[model samples]
Target: MKQSGNSKQFAKKDGEACPRGRPREFDTDTVLTSASQVFWNHGYHATSIDDLCKATGLLRGSLYGVFGDKHGIMLAALDHYAEGSVARLAERLNAPVPAEEALRNALLHYARVACALTGERSCFITNTTLEMQPGDEELRTRVAAIQRRMATLLAASVIRGQASGAFNSTLDEKAVGDFLLCVMQGLRVLGRVAHKEDALIGIVDVAMRALV
Candidate 1:
């Protein structure tokens, strides 16, 4: 019998070939979250569809049916990560504390979390940027936009700090914001190599001093 393109064969418990059904009722959000964690741990180039399936507890057909492909799932995962991260940062920025102090605390929190993670250094977005291929123009563009948003938030905080006399007005707000982003990225890379949390915290502390 001729095999149909849409008719995929899956193995049953007893090892018999079964025709794949209408796909499983997997939650896309849950799957994306799981997939994001997997990518966070293993990174984009290192992570495979098999890894995503294992992480999400879904079969290959189900994963493909829901997410289309590895890139599709990764895009969804990136979106999920960006949303959560931006929200957390915004919350930190809006804290009742002084703007400079709040920004420092936020950076310290991020550094501590990055150092605490067992599997990778730095952030998934940062990791993806380093691993992105030339063909990944769209993904790179998205990453750039996220970075810009982060910079803008940091800049706004710096502006507020200047107004409140928390940070010195000598330094340009935009420059300080850009510097903080670079420092955070540097700390992420350093954390991947060094297990010492103090090293990461030191960077933030010094940056905080410079801001004040």
Candidate 2:
């Protein structure tokens, strides 16, 4: 005879599976994705182990076992975010579309995502730079390296556009790239302040025009 199993065993808790086992092998990718979102929504200082567990649906022991500590998890999450952001930007830069149009669309997309956040306005790297202690040289270096890489990517795109005559060749590549980065960060700040979408769009339009 077939028997019915206990419903409580398969019940969902907080929208996550209430699975039982040796806690299941950790999926690094999924954990990082969830952790990144949590870090994005709540700055490093504000996010706790409990917050991480809730976001990843991992128990406290599982989290510690896989990540070692909060800092380890944060570092992994930051790496994941950085890779995904660069990949998305690269897709736009590599597109066959006109360079000017590609750059503009990329910037606009970034603004939309930034503003979508409920309370935060800036990118996680930017936020971390502002909040992390200066004495934490490792984190500072990591953030700086990531920022430099981003600027380099932007500069390369600008250089390509200039060479193809799609962008203003007269503008300095380094300066233009730096300017764009600042514009993106500024939009994130404005987002935190709950600025209107039109206001951010206006800024993007002006910045894009300057590049072309």
Candidate 3:
């Protein structure tokens, strides 16, 4: 959508005082959070510029100025969600608790979020990844890289568990990490159709067996 007529340009000399009552600057993180929720609720292909504008409270001009286009907004939202996910995983996995317990807690955390009352159930990353077309190599690659980052964090935890005699030493650490990643993604999908929190937690419980 094109910008509304209300959008105006401002010009000032270098030392001029700032215009009074200027609109507050947009918080990019806040906008991305709202946009990410819109994308999660409606897959990337289905979310329109109007939807984003409504969710983020930004005019079309401001949205385009900040993100360039619909695809740009989605990309920014995906990166925002992925960065937060990685940070949370690192915090949980790097804690002083036993590796198995730490991993279980991590899985349980996803379970809780999946079961939350939010109308949308799918994860922002998982939903966006699944919606990607075959020709979207750049998008596919970006998704792969993010998954690898999370998997690496999981693998490191598994390796630590192996070293400490807490996890199955016979299992390949990387493979177990990949498996956990799959389980987490599966929880996101299951969360879409299942409302019962116990169902998701049960899956986490079953997934923990891999560490044993």
Candidate 4:
């Protein structure tokens, strides 16, 4: 996985300890990055505690002591990825460029990620949703909330585009946002099998034209 450029923003001061543990020697953000990469590379079910331990360079005792259990760690990882993704979206949408252009750039950015040469080449939240069991309401709820936040950001951009006459003013902003969300998710799913950036770009072009 690409090391998060925002790691330092989330980094704990060195040597912070969990509620009931020795002082932590490892950086928490760094650990999560590694753990998230492991989860991203391997589905939740296929991932083992040993894999996490090896990836994070922590012993099982340390992992459990810090995160409580594998599930806790997974939640932490999800939060880590989700927070970064939403923050990046906000940054992109808030850029000084025309809103329509920002939206296009955002779509193209994620489209490229969907076809990345390494990592999962899919949204972490989407991957988690697919692996979540029916009984996993908490997991489902978390994913749903994150997706909703993403949709809201997209909707805001749509509204901006409409204000600037870059998009159809008659269209419902929320519905358009939802439509884009579906397209972005579809790109990730299709990219996994096709691994084709050109195909993903074609979908993005369709999405952009639809907004216009």
lDDT of 3 by residue, 1-212 (tens): 12222124211211222246253357788899999989888889889999998999866766776677898898888888899989999999989998888989999988888777353646888788778999988788889999999999999999988999988899998888899999988887788778689999999998887578
Better of 1 and 3 by lDDT: 3
Give the range where candidate 3 is weakest over 10 consecutive residues by summed lDDT.
9-18
lDDT of 3: 0.81
Candidate 3 ranges with C-alpha deviation above 4 Å: 1-25, 117-119
Instruction: Tell me the whole-model lDDT of each prediction, alpha carbons only.
Output: 0.78, 0.76, 0.81, 0.81
Model 4: residues with Cα > 4 Å off, grouped in runs: 1-22, 118-121
Model 4: weakest 10-residue lDDT segment is: 2-11
**What is the Cα root-mean-square deviation between model 4 and the actual structure?**
6.9
Q: lDDT by residue for model 2 over 1-212, one digit each (tens)?
A: 11122223323322333356223455778889899888877888899989999998776656655556898888878888888878888887778887777888888876786678755736776777778886878787778778777777788889988999988989999988888888877777777766477778888999988877
CA lDDT for candidate 4: 0.81
Cα lDDT of model 4 by residue, 1-212, tens digit: 32212222223422333444434356778899888888887978889999998999776666776677888899889988899989998998888999989998898887888788454636677788778999988788889999999999999999999999999999999999899889878877777777788888888899999987
Give the best candidate by TM-score.
4
Q: Provide backbone clash counts, one per model.
A: 0, 1, 0, 0
Clashing pairs in 3: none
Per-model root-mean-square deviation over C-alphas? 5.6, 7.3, 5.7, 6.9
